[model samples]
Target: MSSKLNIFEFSNPSIRTLHISWVAFFITFLVWFSHAPMLAFIKEAFDLSSQQIKALLILNVALTIPSRIVVGMLVDRFGPRIVFSALLFTGSFLCWGFAFATSYEMLALFRFLCGFVGAGFVIGIRLVGEWFPAKQVGVAEGIYGGWGNFGSAAGAMTLPTLALLFGGDDGWRYAIALTGAIAFVFSFIFYINARNTPKGSTYFKPKRSGGLEVTSKGDLYFYLAMNIPMYIALAVLAWKLSPENLGLLSELATNTLYVVLLVLFVFQTSQIWKVNKEHLQKGVAEIEKYKFKQVAILNWSYFVTFGSELAVVSMLPLFFMDTFELSAVTAGLLASGFAFMNLVARPSGGWLSDNLGRKKTLSVLIAGLSVGYLVLSQIDGLWFIPLAVVATMCCSFFVQAGEGAVFAMVPLVKRRMTGQVAGMAGAYGNVGGVTFLTVLSFVDASTFFMVIAGCAALCFILVQFLDEPSGQMAEVMADGSVELIDVA
Candidate 1:
């Protein structure tokens, strides 16, 4: 595949696939977050309490952590083309249901279910990775992620105006339903237009199903250890919604959810062991071994990068409004500059990774991320508005670009399991979001910034252990032939 990509090259199948995949992802995100900008209207309409509002926020992202993992595995098994379309199709009804929900309970259930749409990001990772070659995959994935992610911002910017255009108590409902309608239409468009691979290229599948396969017993343990954080993040979210905290969940309900999480974790661990046991017992070939640490380290990298982005984006408008004494609209616009950077920064991260080498590029960006957060830790009433906005955007560039860099390495890790790898890494991003945001509920904004800066420091240390991709990786064809894919 050529390294050059032209956005206007609609005649090219690969270019066309990129456009379709990104649009599918964009619509999912728009539908997923469409509830956010119209929350004020929903609150008045439903007579929601402050606690109920906070519960809605928590519920929105509640399912995403596991859904990404499940979606990732599905993509690996069924191919991105089907999984991507199916996810969008399923999420559309959930979106519409949430839109028309008449009660808080109905709203909470659908909002939690809508979290499934967040997994849409995991699907595009594998799809773009398949369509583009190693030399260009980074930028290709970056463009897919960066531009596609704009849906949230677009929802934030446009959804309210759309509601006003509809003009009534039910206006927000129609606005949200319209997003679902678009998602419904595009799911079919994606199913028809997206190709799993370029004609004749093999679509690889993992040798075993049920769980991610690891090479060594040591890696088996490491993979299991990494799974704990995702559970812990969920547990923490439950605790946040428990009677003592936000009081959205009754104590009995919270305890039941905790037990459910524990049971699920145990079940998942067994599935993982079952998947890797035979190979570990018989001793796998050297050629098949890839370090699980690569995935673990990348998980933590995203934990800080995209995780901070989620946590910060949620709080930024408030942070700006309070610290800078700006109006809600002004603060929201300035805060949006952080997300706006995703358009250029993510692709730039991928392009730099492609050109400068993945490890080196990610390292520099992460180091900058640490610095950026530390600077953000100092923002207060003393800072000027424009300067603060510039600082926020600069930090976001490193944050979102770091996310692009993380996924750029994901597909390179394992060819057949790119979906699972991206899925776990994607799940970790949500884990990070939950973890960091939970931290925010306790501490002040400055402390939250410092805590993230501290996490970024840890990521910088972890990135050092990453083995840069080079030479070639080997994958087996169905008939037992070995295919070597160039990574350098």
Candidate 2:
């Protein structure tokens, strides 16, 4: 630790890293989410069908599931500096391609690849963990995740105005391209300025690159079981695009995707074995290990928290317009409240986690989330607008706060594989979104919300199994000495 350090001091080395890391994360999010506010412009310009628009939304998140896992391995191996820079630069190119896309298919392809950039969130998880001490890591990570997440809201607020400033049907293209350009330039800037760790601190790597390393045979089984939802989500997306469903893809193409998914699953399963073979054959010393169950619990917790957030955000505008018979602009502005909470609620979640215990904080918030959703499900046209707004705000707090609480536990899972852990948990959040949205495709609006409430109830049960992180987790330094990283 540095002699000039005081945890209360905001200018400490750890806080500096938190500031820079979150800014980079914020930029990544702003670019990644730039499409939402401009969707009307895109739909009119491209003359896309409702199904095509849905597919495009799905495409935006399609590759993120596996991309997060791969990026996690790469970050744990090469360090965040190179990985974050490369992801931003490459994603910028994809964004540029999306902006210039002349056909729906081209736009879909580029957008899907752009999802890889979303993995940048996992990179900061590792970076923040490396810088912050255990006791404060909860608040530090909460601030990084909560504040950085505001980028989406920033994009929503600014990108449309920028497009109008250029003043034409093509203005949306230029506005979106501007985000890409910013990301590309910042990629190089971040590469030049950022260091993976403090001058003398060690950067740890995972024991293997292929999958998360587990300490126990039971955890290995649980880890394997937990991966099912991600694949299921992809398969559902494929089905949605298939000829039998939305007809966005021909039967041949849809069948091909199904085959590709199966092959990828087999390959991923093999890699999991490769990473854990030694531990499976002979377990490591108890002192050298951490349970994979913690990651599993977070995976489910995020599925409900972040997952429900994604689902609610996607549907709220439509729900408001349909339910209240409001104008499109009014519905949109009302819906924006769902996201606006990100600014305060997430930081509040972190503050709560800092003052309260992580597991306790999460349990309380998640319980509130379940009940909130249940209340939201009962709303009808008779409800006052102010009351509806209040309902949304209450539910939004638990959703965003639950998100803050989830990441509060991410860095504490495993010192060497923080990226991988965050990646998996984060990916599951998307899986939850897809699953919940798919349910919406069949159900009424109120029913859809009730379904989320049901899912939240299940997640609350899973949260109980998540152990409070304590003691020092062991990692090996480059000098062949053991280092103990505090988790409590």
- Clashing residue pairs in all predictions, respectively, total 0, 0
Mind giving the per-residue lDDT tens digits that candidate 2 earns over 36-151?
78998999999988888888888888888888888888989999989988888887998899898999889888888888878789898888878777666666777778778888
Candidate 2 accuracy as lDDT? 0.86
Give me the overall lDDT of model 1.
0.92
RMSD in Å for all candidates: 0.9, 2.1
Reference-based lDDT, residue 403, model 2: 88
Error of 1 at 461 (Å): 0.7
Highest TM-score model number: 1
| Model 1 CA deviation exceeding 4 Å by range | none
**Candidate 2 — worst ten consecutive residues by lDDT sum?**
1-10
